[model samples]
Target: MSRRWLLCLALLPCAAQDVIQDWIREIEQSGGGQVLIARAGYDAEANEIRLAPGTTRPELFAEYLHQLAFVRELMAAQALTVSRQTPEEGPLHLILINTARIAGRRDVEEAVIGHELGHAWLRTLGYPAVAAGNSVANCLAIHATDAVQHILIRKELRRRGIDAETPWIATLNDALDQWKVRPLPAALTPCERIQTASQWVDVRLGLDEARWPRITGYEAQLKTRYPDIEQAVSGLAAYLAGQDVAEKEVNRRALLEAVRRLRALAPPTTPLKTNQ
Candidate 1:
C-alpha cells in the first residue's frame, strides 16, 4: 500500500461527549499512562459498579468499563484517536472496525480498541514510524504490544473483582500469558510470522475468526489476509492475490475498501515481488 493508504483513518462514531472529556482528564491527570491503567476504581460491592448480566468474569461489566475509560484516555492522548485523515508524522494509526457492527461484548469490544491502543503505545516506545501496512515492523511491534496489553487487561480485571482461578479470564490470560514463554514461531514468509503471532489472542480464547469478531487477535491476520488492490496490477500481484481473506461481509467489505485505496497507491511495480 502507498503511504497515503497508511495515513488514512476510518470514521468512528462519536462516543458520548461527557464520557470523552471525563476520561481524557483522568488519563491526563493520572501522571503516566501505565498509572492510569493500574489504578483501581470503585469496589464491586459499591453501588457505582455493576457487572454485566449473564456473566460474572467482570470483563463484560466493570472490567469493560474500566478498559473503555482507559481507551478513552488513550484516544485523547492524540495517538489512538481514529480520524479520516492521517498525520505526516505521529504514531502509526490504529485500524478499528465499526464498533457497533462488532458484537456488543464489552471485553471483546474494548480489546479491539486495546489492540489498536497497543500500536499507539508502541509508537511512543520507538516502534518504526511507518504506516500500519509495514508488515515486518508491524508484526514484531504488535506481538510485543499485545503481550503488554495482556498484562494490563488481566491485571485490571483482577483489580475489579476477578480471581486468578476464574475459568474464562484465567484461560484467557493463560493463553496470552504462556505464549510469551514459548519460542516465537520463526518467520518463514513476509506476513506469515506476523499472522501467527496475531492469532495467539483469538485462538486461545476460541473466538471465531470466520464470523469476523472485532477482537484484536485478528489484527495482523486481517492485515495480512486482507486484500490489497496492488495485488492485481503490481508485480507482487500474485502474493497479494493469494491471500486467504475473511469471507464475512462486514469484515470483507473493509478489506475490499482498504485494498481499493492501497491499489490507488500501488507503484508500477509492487515491492512484494520475488527477486525484486
Candidate 2:
C-alpha cells in the first residue's frame, strides 16, 4: 500500500521557518512519514491545498525553500498528539494557511493553525465525520459540527496555555463596534440567521460572558437582530455545553444533536449561503 503524506503550507520569516521545521521533524520521528511543507491556497470545496491562480514557476520552486511556518510551538504540540494517538490515520498534516483569514497577524495565525490542528486531533479520536451529501446539507453539517468542536478545541487550547478566546473576543468586539455606528440589518434570510446564530453560539460557549460582559450584550443584540433563530441557537448552545468532551461517544452525540437542531431552523427548500 502506498503511504499518504500530510501537507502544510505558509509564508513566514526565517526564524518562524526554523521553528516549524522542528515541528515537521517531530511528526516524522513519531512514525508519521516524511513531512512536506509547501505554500498554496486552500480549496475548501475539495478539502485540500493546491497551487492558486497566477503563480509563477519560480514562486512554486521557491516555496519549497521557505517551507511554510506558523507562529509558535503549538503546531509541534498538536502534531505530536495526532502522531501518537492515531498513526494509522496517516502522517500529521497542518493543511493550508489562508493568510487572508489571519490578516497577516502571526499570533492570530498561530491560533488558526492550532484550531485546525485541534480538528485534526479530534478526527484521530474517532469524532464523527460530517456525512457526505449535497452542498446545502454538507454546509449545515460542517457548521453544526464546528459549533460542537469549538468547545472541545477551546478546552485543548486552554490546557496548552493558549488564550483561544482573545482572538474571537477581538473579532466580536469589532463587529459590535461597527453595529453601534451602523444599525444591523432589519432582517435576514433563514439561512443567514441560522449561520449567524451558530457563530454567536461559538463565541458564547468559548468565552465567559461574565468576565467579558460585552459577550452577554452581544447575545442580547443578536437575539434582537435574529429573533427567529434565537431559540434554536440557545438550545444548541445548551446542548453542547452539557456534553463531556472527554469521551469520543459524547462528542459524537453532541455533534449529531447539534446538526439536528440547526437543521430544524434551516429553510426547507432554499439553498444556504455557505461562504463565511
Best of the candidates, TM-score: 2
Clashing pairs in 1: none
Cα miss at 3, model 2 (Å)?
Answer: 18
lDDT of 1: 0.32
Over 73-168, each residue of candidate 2 has an lDDT whose tens digit, in order, gives 112122111122234555444344444345666556555555665665566545664542343464465567678877887887777655556776
Model 1, span 1-276: residue lDDT tens: 422222121122233123323433343344313211111123336734332232222332233345543333332221232211225422223233333223333344334444344433333333222233233433333332332233334443344343322333334444455545763343334333333333343233333445334335434433344334113223222222343322233223323333333334322122221100
TM-score of 1: 0.29
List the candidates' TM-scores in order. 0.29, 0.67
By how many angstroms RMSD does model 1 differ from the true structure? Answer: 18.3
Lowest summed lDDT window (length 10), candidate 1: 267-276
- Candidate 1: segments with Cα more than 4 A from true spot: 1-24, 30-95, 98-101, 104-107, 114-133, 160-189, 198-276
**Candidate 2 Cα errors over 4 Å, as ranges:** 1-94, 189-191, 267-276
